[model samples]
Target: MNLRTFTAVLFALTLPAPPAVAEVGLSPFAGFRMSSSVDIETAGASADDQIHFRDSPSQGLALNFDLAEPGKQGELYFSRQSTSARLDNGLFAPGIESIDLTIYQLQFGGLYFPGGKSYGGFVSGVLGVTRLEPEDSRYDSHHRAALSLGGGYQFFLTEQLRLRLDLRGVYTALNSGGSVFCSGGCELRFRSDGYLQVEAGAGFVMRF
Candidate 1:
């Protein structure tokens, strides 16, 4: 080989390689959720009925993509939880069958990490629909607009694994403009009600 060619090859080998670009990731998680009690009101009724939801388990999955800047991510997520509902009014007999209430949501939001990755805190806001499913055959399920504000912390266990703890407040608006008849032919009209659910849980997050 010529002397100039050998010098060029040596110079090329000594140059540093370019840095790797960050890619998008997907994370799937599972955790437990606890919801607060909601009030059910009826027009022309003497008092309101309270539906107490028991603490239950929840599961979800999330997609994480790059935003305009580094250390910020846009997320699309879906979660579901099932709990038993008990009527807290004296009108119902004791030991009555508890109704099953299932809640689910699909949301889009952005998460920000202040400490520049690794272990940090994040905050996000979500807007979506919340569905309430009742086990009783006579009553149909209901869906309403939902909004949530949440913040959490994430700890990196490995390069592709994380442990997360989250606390969120979910607000749902429920308005059923229908009537239901009691056993004695008395009619009860449903009214607009707001449900505030508080959830706190820890999850294991796997990234891909």
Candidate 2:
């Protein structure tokens, strides 16, 4: 080979390699929710009532796309809980009796790892809306701004799968004096700060 051709080939080989292709992870998780409740003031009643939601099971799925940065991923999260709610007040109220409710959280967010490892711990934050739906035909669904702060560690089980244990503190916004689940027959007025709940979940993350 000619000297010039050899030198050109050598320079091309010395160039740095490109970054590795990113990965995607899908996780279907199941867990429990704690301390879910809301305070309400009935429209035509003198006393305020508390609606207490029972602690129940929650299941969800999360889809994550790896970013250009190592250990960073964009996440789409969704969760649902079907449970019952009862009145805390002793007096009989006309509206919202023996309420069976379904709650959902749909969010978009990201996760960050300080250690920058796939098998290590990471923190996540999600911003979205909390949807509270009643089984009763008279009441309509309610949607409110919500957020969650969470973190967890992933345990490596195989090259294609890992186990993740996660915990999150969720907050749903309830602006004071806002009416919810309103229809001609029954309505509820919210009072107090907001609604707060905690979740603990474990799931398998499949990577591709």
Candidate 3:
């Protein structure tokens, strides 16, 4: 983890225990996002190409506030993933040209347990923005409106501690009005308006 993320986790983990109702909870997770592909048409290219993001490890933190109803909570979630992007059909030789990419997601939404608190099966949905950053200046960072749906099981380890296992599908809506491209040698443009990612995470939640 980076300095900022490490600090936040440490601070959250050291908080004092809360009342019996569990007003709030902090969750620190380690996860990975699945690979994704985007159809692209670059200038000076004879035909269409594809930009692909390889599967990579992801890390994030979640803040949850318990609602008046049992097994219901509102959440603020954030996640980050760093990976490599490559052009399927390009001027460079095969497996030669690669770009470093990072994605950050921030969202707000709700979590619910359908069966009951003891059942542990939960569902969640969040709305937010996904920011894409390219280490190469040839392409500037861009943001897109996004949403995610998730399902998981929560296991209580103690009165104030629990384990969370989650799987999520994240979708981003892209508009042609804006674009993320390279001006130097390669120009990249998306052919579609939808981008999707699947992720799995495991973490410990501290209730307070």
- Candidate with more favorable, higher TM-score: 1 or 3: 3
lDDT of 3 at 58: 98
Candidate 2 colliding pairs: none
| Candidate topping TM-score | 2
Candidate with best lDDT:
2
Model 1: per-residue Cα lDDT over 1-208, one tens digit each: 9999999999999999864444455665676776666655555666777666788778777676667776688878788888776757633323444666677888878778876573469886878888777655554566788888898998888666678777888788766564322223324444546667777766765665
- Winner on TM-score between 2 and 3 is 2
Q: Over 4 Å off in model 2, which ranges?
A: 1-22, 90-96
Model 1 residue runs over 4 Å out of place are: 1-20, 90-96, 116-119, 176-192, 204-208
lDDT string, candidate 2, 139-175, tens digits: 6788899999999988988766889899999999997
Query: Any runs in candidate 3 off by more than 4 Å, and if so which?
Result: 1-19, 43-46, 91-96, 184-186
Model 2: worst 10 consecutive residues (lDDT sum): 89-98
Tell me the lDDT of model 2 at 124: 92
Ranking by lDDT: 2, 3, 1
Report the C-alpha displacement of residue 75, candidate 3, in angstroms: 0.9
TM-score of each: 0.75, 0.83, 0.83
